[model samples]
Target: MSTARKHDPISVQDYLAGEAHSDQRHEYIAGVVYAQAGGTNRHNAIATNATVALANQLRGTGCRAFNSDTKVRIRNAAGTRFYYPDAMVVCRANPPSDSFQDEPVLIVEVISETTRRIDEGEKREAYLEIPSLAGYVLVEQSSLSAVVYQRGRQSGGDQGFQRSIVSGLDDVIQIDEIPLELTLRELYEDVELAEPDSTDRS
Candidate 1:
């Protein structure tokens, strides 16, 4: 993401108004707006696979899965920010007119070379502040792997989070929060991955 403007801080109301009529999507961080870059073929495939899998499993359960077009709003001491996650699951429905969701049970982000820093650092930090978020997932575009952060039951806040890694196509990620399981094979389906580098060991 790159800064869209360099002017003084803009109000959330003004940002929303501009977004409604804008041709491109931008993520709002506090008062600054950052233009979102288009995803690669693999990025789009992975995001679509996850969204479709979640949406299918969530049917008739009152929970809905959303694609990158939907924004997740986070407000905390770090200030108000709006991010477009690759995929998200919201158990509680938002109003029909709302453009963003404040309460999401699960959030997924497909990370690439350009987005790895913000997706794993700033975005992760801001998302952990949401009391309603039960799980945050970072999917790697370069390989068949994922890093999941689940909120521990023993405590609250960021300290109560537990991180786990799931790698390989045969592994499955069990999201107990939403009671759903996703396999790496399904997530990487139709996506072309790079060949692993072979090391010379004598």
Candidate 2:
């Protein structure tokens, strides 16, 4: 089977220190790194649409939301992550340049069939490890569904402990840390379905 940047295994720190101006998105797993294919215009639009919505909702608040351009570092030696998210919101304030975010209140990843399973499965599992993470949201570009996970403690029968998965966007998802009033419709405002040739039409 093919791997996503399997040739070279790098630490989270090493991947961050390097420049990403070369293009091609990348994902980091454990310690290995790999590149991602460019998304179609619709894919790009979905991400942009969500970013704007979140940004607008978060304005004036101390919280800050970022597009894929921002690097999310976690559990590394210093700052930066092996993989960058499609969209993210941080309630802890921005970090200094050259350093990645150590505290993130919310993380959002746009689901792609190619990576959807992993994003909702393996990637999700990895995100749950972040101590400062309050929520993780997934926006499905296909059905325009948003799956949200929130931080809190829940009673699990005799074994009560920490829990997540606050609510979903089958109706409309709201992220508590990121202004707590955003709706899924805003994230899909201008998004359209992909064509047969995979071209995004206006």
Q: 1-202, model 1: which lDDT tens digit per residue?
A: 7645743588899989988898888889889888887776777889999999999989998899999989999988768899999999999868979999999989999887667778889999999888888899998877889999988664453446789999999998887877888899989998887434311110
Predicted candidate 2 versus true structure: per-residue lDDT over 57-164, tens digit per residue: 788887777887776666644333455677778888554564356677788887666666678776677676777777788766666466777766436522211333
Which residues of candidate 2, in runs, are more than 4 Å off?
11-13, 76-81, 153-170, 177-179, 194-202
Best by lDDT: 1
**39: Cα error in model 2, Å:** 1.2
Per-model TM-score, in order, reads 0.91, 0.77
lDDT values for all models: 0.84, 0.64
lDDT score at residue 124, model 2, on the 0-100 scale: 78
